[model samples]
Target: MTWLRALREIVRSGLTIERTRLEPLVALRAAAGVAIVIGLALWLVSPAYAASSALGAFSAGAATFQRSWRPRKVIALAAGAGLALSTFLGYLAAGHLVTFLLLLATWSFVAGMAWAVGPTAGIVSAATVAGMLVIITLPTSVGQALEHAAVIALGGVVQATLILLFPIRRWGAHRDALADALAAVADYARRLSHDPTAPFDAKPMMTARSAAAVTPSQARRRPAALHGPRGLAERIRPAVAALADPRVGAPAEGPGRDRAREVLGAAADVLDAAARSIRRGTPAQVPSGAMETLRIDEGDEVLEGPARQAAVRLASLLGEVLETADSCDTHVVPAPARGAADAPPLLRPTMFRLVPVVLRAMRRELHRDSPVLRHAVRLATVACLGYALGTALPLGHGYWAPIASVMVMRPDFHQTYARAVARFTGTLVGVALATGVVQLAHPDAYLSGGLAVVSAALSYLLMRTGYVASQSFTAAYVVFLLGMGGEAWDQTVRDRVLLTLVGGALAVVAYVVFPAWETPRLLDRLADWLAANGRYAAAVVRGYGDPAGQRRADVRQALLASRDANAAWGEAFGRAKQEPVRHRGLTRREAEDAQEAVQSLGQAAMLLETHLPERGARPVPEAARFAEALEADTAQAAREVRARRNPDWDRVEEALDAWEGADSGMDPVVRRGAELQLQALEELATAVDRTPLERDVASSRQERHARAEEEEESRRERDTGPAPPPKEEG
Candidate 1:
């Protein structure tokens, strides 16, 4: 029995190992490098090491192949290949170790620059360039080196081939799982639209929305990952981007479709909320009829237990959706009614008048002495200094400069400093390990190859975990290359340790100088976001429901822009928090209000899309009035934080509610448009204050359904000829 249990465990372990696919490929490629190392030790280096390195590199390439169907992924992979090849040629041309190191450092800078565009491209570029440079510059005979390079190329080819061979079953599963999750979220959105009792907390909504965004990615590359959260975000990144686009919000046309869309949006919000609540140790509940409104599909079956449970929990939140109609303060709030103190000082010459004051204020806020600017300056300086010191160092072989640069640069003081320390420590440890292995094994070709393979495998595992792991793995490869270069393990270890420290120190010094504050940039982004949303809201309010094609396109673009702005705003504010107040261009409360206003606009746009067509043909009087009221409300909301005394939220809500409810009479197009617009506005308002109107909407739906069922029963009874309906047995 014990033996059987042990055998089962062994099989499972092997299966797991095989599943990763990176391990074996790493080991194989490492052997190629190992052969060179052994030959260098014996002065009879073989070409086999090149093949091994190629294979290892190729396997590393395969790791990213998991994201292969995506164009972005393909582009990233291609860029990495190009960068590595370019770095190698540069190293070959220079021949001098110092020159090679400089080229490698340049490669690192390029990689960092690319990172601002995309993460995958940046990492791949960094890794390939660093690796190739090490291989090209390392000590080896011409014949042996050529053969090794060939083998390495072969490895890359094989890795790419392997990626294409098997059907990736995980792709569909991931997609389906994501879809199910989104569907659950949609259910919650629907409840919130009608039910005013919904919790509708912003944090939870954000969280759930974030989670829902992961589906498109999962649908694309479902890697054969045994159920775990590892690499989940990376896989779903693209899908998240797509979901943020509002044009995709086209509601199904026909009866209940508008209602369904409202439901879906609210459900999405609820799912977002529940996901958040779950993190905070409580789960949100769904309202009654939440699930009934959503279009459930078999794709939902793809979710495993946890995802299913999450969906169920999210559904429960719908039951508790807010009933906010009663909270509507049916009062008209005057527009632009500012107090004397609330007004900005009159500018005699406009731009010139405020220029001096603005400049003085900005100088005081964004001074070089400010912590935020100081941090940015330090980050850039550290990167530059790391490069300079690495160029000066007598580091034997490879691109120490680039490696040092990556280790030294950071988003902030702690990260920059911490990375440098980690890099130094990891390098020293790696060198020591390499030296010990060389001494104990006596540099036999087989043994060296084995060690190389082991290092590659370890690197693949460590890369995703964090930079420290990657740093150590890089050191192991460096040692292997040095061995191939005919350097003794002890000398290689000593040189590596010293140069790493030098590079690290230089990077640290650079970071402390000329820090660039990002606070102003964040504010600028927020302002841009606000302006874009304002335009979108204006377009929607003015032209709801009419010519479908052009208007839809405009509204869709606006919606997408608004979502992008929200995302950008969130990221900007999050980063700004690390900086001092002086560096922050916008006040915290002001920023919050801006986000809220944009969100309200989004809701308003949705409402117009829904109700405008139905009510558009009605008497132009009320519609025109509603438009004016909406515009006024929006302007007020935009400047809400800047007001001397906070305006009445209740009055704002009431005006929006009343405007949304105004009848356009029996015109279906106008009625639907109005209803949709109203529903959307109500939701946005309810977000701030749980209005009873939402609840009334939900109850009305229930009554309508009941009445519908009753009518059907009565018709059936009449058709059956009434007397025969009674039980004959009685």
Candidate 2:
């Protein structure tokens, strides 16, 4: 990408508004928490102290609204504590410029690294950096600083207390995650009737699993409905895929295909009903009518072989789903159990015990190539340099400079650049609004406080709508906050605007110096996804060859690993597309094609998973050898892919040919399925090896050939009148 194009993209992305449903009530509630803190502080101390308290309360409440799985109150409390601590430390060091800058650098770096934990943690920590810069300057003495810090902590306390008193949809995120998982499966089932090769989205399931990881305290209060259905959905995916697949379960046409379609539709209905029940925390009564299709009648044509087994399994699981998705207040239903040898349960430690866990996660990102590590280095450098430059310039707005840098810079290239552009735009608008208010109406203290609250409320409501909107309100809130404290905002707004531009410039330039572009990581991510997909596919295929020795738990773990790798590659690919770096080895078209190939590889494995034979059933004689070869070949292919070399699947072909030459003894069904797996592997190899030049040449030749054929057909039509329409494929 050229610099001009990149700049245009950054500006466009920065200004793009997201269309999210407005939740006025939630925003109002959080605003009320800020208002309460402000009102109390004004009644007791003064507006200056009230501004500090409001900053703390508003920041805490904002953090709670971020994408966190924990209870909102817990997030509020954690944010408050972090803000209080940073506030206290920042003030203590503020007495010396050298000391404060060093501390600021360290704090900013830690805040950047916090992203390794999650977005919620990372964002809350960034808020702390802002609080340290903006909120700490109010205190004059050490004693006053301590008092102000306590007030900031109190602000968080008020927000948490308000949330506890009037909660809005408790465990709402968790419910949505689980409901979405079930809904995705339902949608997949529906599509399978018409498109047998429909691929399942792993994102919803991944989200549900993340939501299921609960601290002991959370586990105690978690609803019964959220516990059991996720596991069932995971198990049902393979069964449904198998039943719809022509090679494995049902015939391509005839009575069996019709039965498969009917079973799929019925499964979709039941899953949808269960989803609604779980989401609403209602009784599972909605499935009563739709559940009958799951029952095998005396004359039903669909009840036979693997299709019959899958239908029966689906019915049994739906029964479990109905049994679990209800308003059961008796005892919380236990989460599904796995074999002792399976992966550990999704248990989270108490928040107090999360320090080590977070540290370990951060530690893992300490490597040179880690984006989180590079972001930390970039953040620290920009923050410190921005502060020095801001202080040295005519506009000595310490908070404005560093806060702009801290808020705009993200771990990814696109966001960092986009946010820097957005930050400047938002700052200008916000500062202009503040300046207008000052010039037009010099509101009294109470009115200024009210205006600040209103501004904050607007920010909360629009946080997810766009970076520009929320950031504008946030900037205006700070101005109004200072205005409430008897500050001369007319001149201050101009200074802040200048410093904001400087800060944004610093952030953008810093990224270029300490770059962490996703382009370089794409190959690594692709290799990882390829290897993981191989292992997962191999595991599923091996189960058919060695059913007695197969561990379902191992297969399940492999599937999870593959999904994780797929997600990682997807994230990198998305970021890489937006980045302005040179393409590394693989072009954009090749990357996309390779992704599709890997997806097909996983989809084929999913189909195989649906038909693993019982232990006593006969296994294909050469299946084990073929599966072993596939595993080794794909692993090697992954290594080659990382080096930008075409993968050789000669070993895989040899194994398949050997199986084919000797498969006179194997069942035709299993034999055909193995061939399907081989075909998917070959497609993956072709996808990875084909160059853009080759594809373009091939397409051009095909288009010319097609035109010549069309001319010949037209000539025939002129000579023989309109030819009969070609018959459609059966």
How high is each candidate's TM-score? Answer: 0.54, 0.90
Residue 288 error, candidate 1, Å: 16
lDDT of 1 at 551: 54
When summed lDDT is taken over every stretch of 10 residues in candidate 1, the lowest stretch is 322-331
lDDT of 2 by residue, 1-730 (tens): 5667877775665456665446677899999999998988888999899999999999998997798788888889999999999999999998889999999999999999999998888889989998998876789899999999999999889988988999888887898899999999999999999998887789999999999998887777888787778888887888888888876777677777887898789888888888888777776655444767677775775456667777777777767776777644434646453311124347887798999999999999999989899999898888888878877887656668878888888998778777888778888888788778867888877778888999999899877766677778888888888888878777588789888988888888888888998898788899999899889988887887887888887888999999999999999988888877767578787788788888888887877776677788777657788788889998998899888877767677678767644734544555556666666665566566657775565455446435654775686578679954422332
Query: In candidate 1, what are the lDDT values of residues 219-309, reduced to their tens digit?
Result: 2332212122111221122122111212222222332234334344645554444333332223344455545644334564422222233
Give each model's clash number: 81, 0
Q: Which stretches of candidate 2 lie over 4 Å from their true place?
A: 1-20, 285-289, 302-304, 327-331, 334-345, 619-621, 663-670, 690-730
Residue-level error in angstroms, candidate 1, position 658: 13
